[model samples]
Target: MARQPTSGHEGEAPQKLRTSRQVYDQIRWDPRLDPAAFVIGYETRESGAEEIGLPRFDPEGDIPWHRIRYIRQGTTTVWDRRSRVDLLEGKRSAPAPSAQCGLDARPVHRSALALIPPREAWAPIEAIRQAHDRHVERWMPHINLLYGFLPEAAFAEARGAIAAALRDVAPFEVTLDDVRRFQHRAGATVWLHPRSEPPGALEALQARLEALFPRCSEQSTVSAGGFTPHLSIAQLRGEDGEDGEALVAEWRRMLPITFQARAIHLLSRRGDEAFAIRHAVPLGEPSPEGGDR
Candidate 1:
């Protein structure tokens, strides 16, 4: 039962549909939209439909989506997708803590997108980072793709899109071929440079994923230089560390930390804890919609 489009003098019309499948599909496929607040209803033999609010309904038959006759996100009657009616119309009184498409918004970075080397390869990198790298306790050995990623709750809905985007990307080998340093005003940081032969695959995959969450453009090498992917292993400062130049030479001598780049990991962490894997989107193979593994 499609409802007539409400008369609007300013914004666009809400997408019309008869069932709740469309609502779930949009939440599944579109990465930019989310339901910060919602209500779902079922058709009854009586006059009005049976309605229930979210985070409150019980799944009697384990088939809630099938019974959903109509849905509303905030104040907007969300029939098909949030993109259609959530244009400042679904404004709720109390906003979501980290709503992707909610009326209330805040910067969130409890999760990240990274290319993690296999557990087999963590030995040497961890060995070096344990002593010198200051961020060892906070992060695993990873090549950061998009830090300050989408809020943790959004990853479930975004997984479908993430898999679709990486469907064609074949697994490739990544090498930490050389040692480089970024000099600061006070201290200098040394890192291992990442290289993948026929070089653009890693960077291209990064760019593609970045497009999905257009807001996480913090690490984009737009003006500074091309994407210079690196793994931080050592730090040298004036207070109490090895010589930056000597450390670079030493790491270079022990250069070429290599591993197969099979899948990209979606990582998350609890309060003040080290980040851990949430999902691994395998290259060339589409990751199925499911829980973390």
Candidate 2:
């Protein structure tokens, strides 16, 4: 659960609350905007009140303020700059009515590339994912090949680039042989390791995509040099205790899950919203002489 912003009145004015450090770090700040200059506010009903906060803005500051028209769902908050522009330009005199917030909140689209396993594979994986991932219901089970923020304006160009990069790629098979754990500062993440020799077809596909659109790989924490092709099963927090380790061991025992990968899907969501498949590009059929790679 996410911490809701605290609200209080300074004299007759309502003060906007600063998000918690954890939530603040999760914010996908636009590269064009300065983090120091950005302040998030909720919308207030009162007209002609202070709706915007400046650099001196503080959640605990003694200042009279109104709300900004924005919606928060779960741990994610999203706001459109156009609303602020409208207010400033006198095109709008008051904040728009607040809408429902959370995962169910209206989606804003963004894009990524992933390899989706068939339903037979997804069924069991989804069960394990739900038990482990905090945001399991919001996302599907898939191997993320390339994930980046592709805005609608650049969607066509990005789609074209991805399609071209995968033009010669043939469909391949993946076998999840065992559970592997990667230790992180947060905790341990358990994943399904594909049974492939070093620098296999999956690696080759990722490399080709990275070469085509180098910028798409820029924001990823796992760099191309250290890329490991696997389907994430669960992200165990530090507090999950010995029970978490037991679960990982149990999953490892259920090894060698295999599936055929035929198409690369382009998935996207706005902010931290739920992802949906936007495009499916099929991998090239194997040549008669080569057979399935």
Candidate 3:
């Protein structure tokens, strides 16, 4: 029997086409997004090309990777300065990454991502969820620290709003001293947990975020009642709870990992469901010597 294509997908989906990253103006930055500066993901060059127009992007590069589910951005495509120019005049093809080095860079399309559910998304804020989740995952027992860094400044409004909310509580530092199992009725999660009481700063930060994006999933916010800072290891999809305990027993031996809290981020999802840093602000950086920005 032949497999019929889904509603939207027909014989073949349009290929994105191979183009120079530089010419395309579709750049990915590390940790933060600075419009004035763009970082190369991968570098490439082709023969006879005047200069390297786009940096090579090696999707297989050895960088710590995580996957994000996609959510919709507002309608209407807006272009940055460089992207505006590329669209007006058709894009030009440059040498491939291997053309310069000995590597062969192939064009690849990413898979569509599923979204995080609305309920579970915000449930992480509630204490009941945390307690049961910790029991189920096992890895939740050891979080001693919490750190959030925004990959872009656009989300500053969201992150800043959250931080302000935590102000009344006075922020506390966090330490995810170890990893533990996080379980819920839905499934098990391998996540990190805070070691000490986070400064009231965190509480206030959550308050602001909740107030600003009220419609967002409750799991998304960090309020006095909802915040438990931790690093995620993995999420389990299986229904068997017994396996969770065994996995935790084996994983607990690797305990006590620590990270610093420098900043928090507001991540935005693209049509493809890729998460991009939209905004970020430092948690511990001192203000300028003179005054404010």
Candidate 4:
């Protein structure tokens, strides 16, 4: 089906930048910006132009063997133009790591990106998860964006890049208005449904972060609906006889939970210990020396 050209009206979608040069130009065009100060982008294609202003991007264009397919800003290549070799798959890998782990979660899943609600918000949600969840001990009341994050060595260096990517993103408020669930092999896990005022804002934020670390995508690989921003509060796969559908229905009738998502928590744990926030990078700005973590 041919996609129709939309009438460029008030509610029309913003046009996507065609090339890396154009994207760079747009950023440069802004008067309040300094070019060299910013050295970040989650997309290798973001600077794939043959110099600065190549007329067009040719997928099959003549290329060089060492055409700068990757650039590591913080000792980590945020994006690689070429696909990675997934040994398990015996082929080039998907854009996101799909074979690393499933929804079952890895036993050694150490690092992660999450939106942890304030301590005040924790008490109530904590009570709920504790009563129903079989695997709710180590985690705080939070929503997972991307799990299985960078190693501890790269984490400190990577913080600056994460902060840079989020420099212009203002804090957003989220409402845990309802309850939801994901059915696993043996049972189901109930979770808090998070929604933003404008809608899709949370999803957009997740997408941007995922672009930065495509390999840390264990949560999204098995999710057929793509990245679902959710806070798993209750695990129903154990000896408990709680009904997932019933809990979701009951929570739906209750009052919704609200919190300010002012920052993205960089959580990590070693071995079997509980997860703790190593850093909480603030939205719209780089965090201070100590950080608010």
How much does candidate 3 score in TM-score? 0.36
Tens digits of per-residue lDDT, candidate 1, 1-293, equal: 33434534558765443335534434322445543366665654433466655423322222356556656777666663322333333333443344563211232456778898888888878888998887788788888787657766666666777888888889888888888876633355678888986587789888988887765554563224645677878767654345656666776787677888988888878777788887877778766554366
- Which structure among the candidates has the greatest lDDT? 1
Per residue, candidate 3 scores C-alpha lDDT tens digits across 12-90 of 6643422333323333221122222322222123221111111222232221112111111132222223222123122
After superposition, which runs of candidate 1 have C-alpha atoms over 4 Å from their true positions? 1-107, 221-223, 239-242, 289-291
Residues 248-272, model 4: lDDT tens digits: 6776776488888888888887777
In model 1, what is the error at residue 211, expressed in angstroms? Answer: 1.0
**Against the hidden reference, what TM-scores do the models get?**
0.62, 0.57, 0.36, 0.60
Error of 4 at 84 (Å): 29
| Winner of 1 and 3 under TM-score | 1
TM-score of model number 1: 0.62
Order the numbered candidates by TM-score, best leading.
Answer: 1, 4, 2, 3
Ranking by lDDT: 1, 4, 2, 3
Error of 2 at 176 (Å): 1.1
Candidate 4 to truth, TM:
0.60
Q: What would the per-residue lDDT of candidate 2 be over residues 29-66, giving only the tens digit for each residue?
A: 23333334444544433332232222223322223223
Write down the lDDT that model 2 would get: 0.55
The per-model lDDT (C-alpha) reads 0.65, 0.55, 0.34, 0.59
User: What's the alpha carbon RMSD for model 3?
Assistant: 17.6
- Model 2, residue 106: displacement in angstroms? 22
Better of 2 and 3 by lDDT: 2
